[model samples]
Target chain A: MNLSWMAWTQPTAIFFIVIFCLLITMSIWEKISPGGGPRVGILRFETTRGDRLFLSLLGSAFIHLAWLLFAGSNLWWAMGVSILYAGFVFSFV
Target chain B: MNNKPFDNKAWFFVLPVFILVAISAVIPLMTVVNYSVQDSFGNNQFFWAGTEWFTEVLNSDRFRDSLVRNLTFSAIILCIEIPLGIAVALAMPRKGIWVSVCLVLMALPLLIPWNVVGTIWLIFGRADIGLLGFTLAKMGIVFNYGQSWLQAWIIIILMDVWHWTSLVVLLCYSGLVAIPEAYYQAARIDGASRWKVFRYIQLPKMQRVLLIAILLRFMDSFMIYTEPFVLTGGGPGNTTTFLSIDLVKTAIGQFDLGPAAAMSLIYFLIVLLLSWVFYTVMTNYGMDAPEKREVES
Candidate 1:
């Protein structure tokens, strides 16, 4: 609620930290196996692990925003739904 | 996975680019995300808004209208430029001194600064002193972009086509010239018709470049701001106010930081979604064909 230089609120920082961690994890995964595992899923295209991560993250952001608008501010349910959605994306899409 | 040795030194080369991206894109984007979730009064004071601005922007008729307008513009131009570019590229000499001349001419418009491109069109479309406007007047076609929305749209579309069609042409030309002489010789030996040659050989070769052209044009046109802003100022009753122009009006013209920030996130999300869809669909379509063909053969 209080302003700071560059608007570095705690939650926002956490959001970015999570994204950074995901990137580092992905990099490590790639280092272990240089060829990313790309497969055709429900999306009907070849998507590497990195692509799946991107799709999941992008979809989750929209899901989060939509839930915030329609279901009110308690985002715990939205978070749960997003996790299931991400799992689905990783497994099949 | 191939057994390539680990090379931590690669990260040293990549780190500078990563830092640049973090400083230029990530930091600024985080600031926007922060502003989007907070309400701001003057003097840098802020209160938690908690998605209120997102709701407001989503519900606004102005946002809806501008989005529709933006999508329509992008669609119309893509329809025109892609085919037209292909034809022009096809017509150009595949090998000769004239190829260099053609390339230099095509690149001229792209080299001009964007605002200058806007300024050029703003003057060129003026009914009083401009060549296009004067010619239209002489032909008995009444032309006033300030009063008529259709006329304003015409000029904007025309300006865009003139400025950007070269990009498509250049890309398609590259795609065309890359076709080895053997393919053409084979087509000739087969006695294939012109249309057949293009359909089987030339068109398939051009597919990758066409994808690049379409993606670039879609993103650029969807986020267009400067040319229309300079030319029409989003006037003629806001008929030409696309998403970026409207976002600027919200953020800078009215100085509403929260709503503007929220609008930007929405805009970015839409663009990201569409770009990904286009990328997936195009890559999927092209990457599957050879497998099927090989199996059938």
Candidate 2:
């Protein structure tokens, strides 16, 4: 939490911490099961779990930005939408 | 299908690289994200404004115009550079001492710093003093890039083609040389035409490197700032004020941190999405070709 060196806000720091946690959780999941083979999805590419995580994160960023542009500053709706998108990416892509 | 034993111990080896990337990239990127959602007054006073800048920047005429310019520039450069690079690569000598000399010469332009390349063209295109414009002035035709938008565009595009076509040529040349002699000998024995030889053997071999060349060129052109900035300061008028130059004017000149930060994030996302699309399309295109050939046979 002592992030003055980089001048990070609490929320922004928490956002990155969540991403870091996701990575750790993913590694642990991979270790427990170990068969995250690349699967061709509707996106038409072979993507493993890691790649799907990446896709979800990237998609979420765009979704958040788009939401801000069109729907204004109430971003809780955007976060909900992003969570669903990540679910969709994980399940299918 | 990596079936090696799943060991938790392996993560430690990758930790140093992860930490380095975190320090270099993620930390700075977080700072930008922090600024994007906040309003900052002088002397480090900040208040959370929550995406007001993002909406403003996205809706602005200036941002939209600069984006269109950036896209057009990337498209024009990619269209010109890729084929030219491939053609120059094909024309290169494949044997003897000439190959090294040719490579060194090809690399000379790339060796020049980008700003220096811009400065060189700035002087080189001046009508009264420089060779290109002076020679044109000596004839009936007179031109000044500073005065005309079209002339500025022409000079910037010409300068880019001269500077970066070498990169494509180098990548394609490396791809060409990797093709075995046997393929050429077989093609020759088949009495294949020059075009057929190129279309079938040489091109398929160059596909990987060409993908790399195209991706690099597209990304570089989109993010281009130094050369055109130095030459015409993003060319001339509304047409040549690409996103980067516009971003700098907002961030540094106006010192509008919120809008600039928002623009930077938007710009970063656009590049990331396009690069992803390009990678997907090129890889799938290459993958489909061999499978289609197999099915036809």
TM per prediction: 0.88, 0.88
Q: What lDDT does the true structure give each of the candidates? A: 0.88, 0.87
Q: Give the number of the best model, judged by lDDT.
A: 1
lDDT of 1 by residue, B126-156 (tens): 7788899888888999999988999999899
Candidate 2 chain B worst ten-residue window by lDDT: B288-297
* Pairs clashing within candidate 1: none
Deviating ranges (above 4 Å) for candidate 2: A1-10, A35-37, B1-16, B275-297
Candidate 2 lDDT tens digits, B11-64: 899999999998899878898888887888756767777768888998999999
- Separate clash counts for every candidate: 0, 0
Q: Which stretches of candidate 1 lie above 4 Å from their native place?
A: A1-3, A24-38, A68-74, B1-4, B278-297
